[model samples]
Target: MAKPKLPIPVTLLTGYLGSGKTTLINHVLSNQEGYKCAVIVNDIGEVNIDAELIQKTGVVTQKDDNLVPLSNGCICCTLKVDLINQIAELVKSGKFDYILIEASGICEPLPIAQSIAVLEGDEEEGTPAICRLDNIVTVVDALRMATEFGCGDNLLKDDVDEEDIESLVIQQIEFCSTIILNKVDMVNEEQLGRVKAMIKTLQPKAKIIEANYGKVSVGDILNTNLYNFEETAGSAGWAQAYDKDEDERNEHHDHDEDEHEHHHHHDEDKHEHHHHHHHDGEDHSNCDHEHGHCCHHHHHGDDDEEYGIGTFVYHSRRPFNQEKLQEFVNNWPKGVVRAKGILWFSDKDKRDYLYVFEQAGVQITATENGKWLAAFPKSEQKKYFKEYPDIEEHWDEKYGDREIKLVFIGQHMDKPNIIERLDNCLDD
Candidate 1:
């Protein structure tokens, strides 16, 4: 009756080119805060170059320090064949407490997940997994999402063929468990709102964190232990991957009822339990691909077409009635697959602190963030605004960055009503 040993967290960082994956990697390595961390650069040539840059931060080099560079970095080269073996080698080294796998810009991240998915499951609850897949963090450049990764509102634009790189970008967004909307500073408010809305349509299940230059709190990305095999495999492109496998493992049992019950699973299921929206659990049992169902995975064909979806942004300087805000969050109207930003409450206790808001579904939870810049004296304001100049755009000389700014996305969202409801909550 031995308890399973804790599985070390293995985080996979995926993003398109110039999406700030390396920056985030550098940040993690530079500010490891004494964690015996190991960085595994799986991309072909980028790892060497990126490693050099990371070393420039004055952190010891992995070659002489804490990094491991792997070959076959090209997408065309060997992929799944030796990836697991390489991971096993790192695990055996026993030199690190946490391991980070950075996916090349071109490679699909799901295959990387399945390579580890075989290890996580409730059936193996008593037996520790080789490594727990902590999170599939995708660093999306907000500016690029609009200009480069033209992901419209549609999650499955299967009717239209897609170009190679464009499709890959969309797939990466859809497959992640948490998405870092990096490079937020590069875009204007209008562009930022559109990009967030587009992302919501593409991957409503992924928890979105608005980040600038990958300057996200380390606690948000690593060691959170929020990865759930059953729940995570619900994104549009990778939904039902593990569940389909689980059903096969239990063939003798009557999985038919359970299968049918969730066969038409909606986005609400994924968000109901957590922020990320769930996909329809349609059975692709007929898929014959060697690596589970291939229907949802993108092949990135030549005829990629842009999706046409709506986006809405609400920026208000007034503080909200705490009761009204909470009530609206509890029973908000349908739609708004993704809603996230900062909230300002009128209540004395709540007003002093910035309330961080992120929602995958109807359920929205507001947690206390650090104080608003307005709370600090004018002389000390530069220290706060130095990192986020964008905050200064909306900063009131008297109020500072104290406002309820939320970006919401849905199918032809009732933007006006949503705006009105929020405005109604404001104190006179």
Candidate 2:
């Protein structure tokens, strides 16, 4: 006889460095109901604030403590084996109904998920039941995310890569079902709008919540099932809008790209062409991109300097020239801190395409695009391709794929110059 499968909901709490993940988890543990919770807090250095906070919740702890701590700090690659063993022990004890794993700020959730996805009954003893992943709620520092798009100061290591920080933040947000934008009190009303808009651009499906010192409701952050593999690959806001079924959306995006390209060319003719266009929009009267002064009124640089943080979207209908794009990416200007989005290159060996996120002048790999053959199951592909067949007869005939889409974030940089360099890389 086999044991019944239990609904073991596991919530993953994660965020960037100094984003107050521990503080949010402490509040969850204190306010949880209708479940016996087992928390596994993975800490990087000496401080285990999440573990300490959960322990103070007066829940029953297994011997050697239920809080499995991985002090080595590389959870993305090395912590899976220990995590599986601890989960097995806890399930066997039958003392917990739900589980929560507080991932280290720098860790990626893919490997941890892969470990849980492969769990089997033979590896365990008493309770050999299937465990389900529930919610992944990311806690964000509103103030920090406003000023710093992706890069963070690493006080621990001397040579910390800023590229790694951007990649990690994007990965965490992409996989999570909900994102909690904590530390709201530190930012003003205008700043809050900017943060929300930025987050909406990065992750459209996520439900963003504002909190100060972990004041968010635990119920809202839990129980969401948002872990589909295909959707996760194209989960960003811009990507989602680009991925819809309607031909009208595609045409609209294409028209938008054409308009943007026209503007880029017009701006190149004379710098005064974009003199009045604000960073957010043209409607705001006080804003001006010509002077490098934003309406946020943060007082960035001196009178002679132009230093304000901003983001913009770039879209292309054709693939890039690989060598030219590489040169452009490597030689980014000084004020530009981060630029990320998907790119299609004609010279790349891999057909699936690539995702690039540049931070502090380093480009880090996010993932390869979805496989053309795997897009639809064999049975469905036969039926679907009949109506909308690819006339190009591509190597992978069934799936339709196209060009570069990027989002640029910079501080006090010349937008016209940036757009010009990037446009030269794309095939005309």
Misplaced by over 4 Å in model 2 are 1-5, 46-50, 60-65, 120-129, 150-163, 225-233, 244-323, 333-388, 391-419, 426-428
Give lDDT for model 2. 0.56
TM-score of 2: 0.66
What's every prediction's RMSD, in angstroms?
A: 22.8, 10.8
Clashes of each: 11, 0
Model number with the top TM-score? 2
The sequence of per-residue lDDT tens digits that candidate 2 reaches over residues 145-184 is 6666533332233334433565567667656667888888
Q: For candidate 1, lDDT tens digit of each residue in 1-428?
A: 23224465788899877788889988887787756677767665533666566567765466653566654463224656466766666666666667787777766776777776655535646754667888889888788666644323332233223325555666677677889999888898877777775666666567899988788878777887766755655554222222333334235323222111111101132322222323332322222222111111111111111232433445555678988887777666554555555567888777767776766432356777577667767666765467655445435544455655454544445655676677667773
Q: lDDT at 360 for candidate 1?
A: 46
C-alpha TM-score for every candidate: 0.52, 0.66
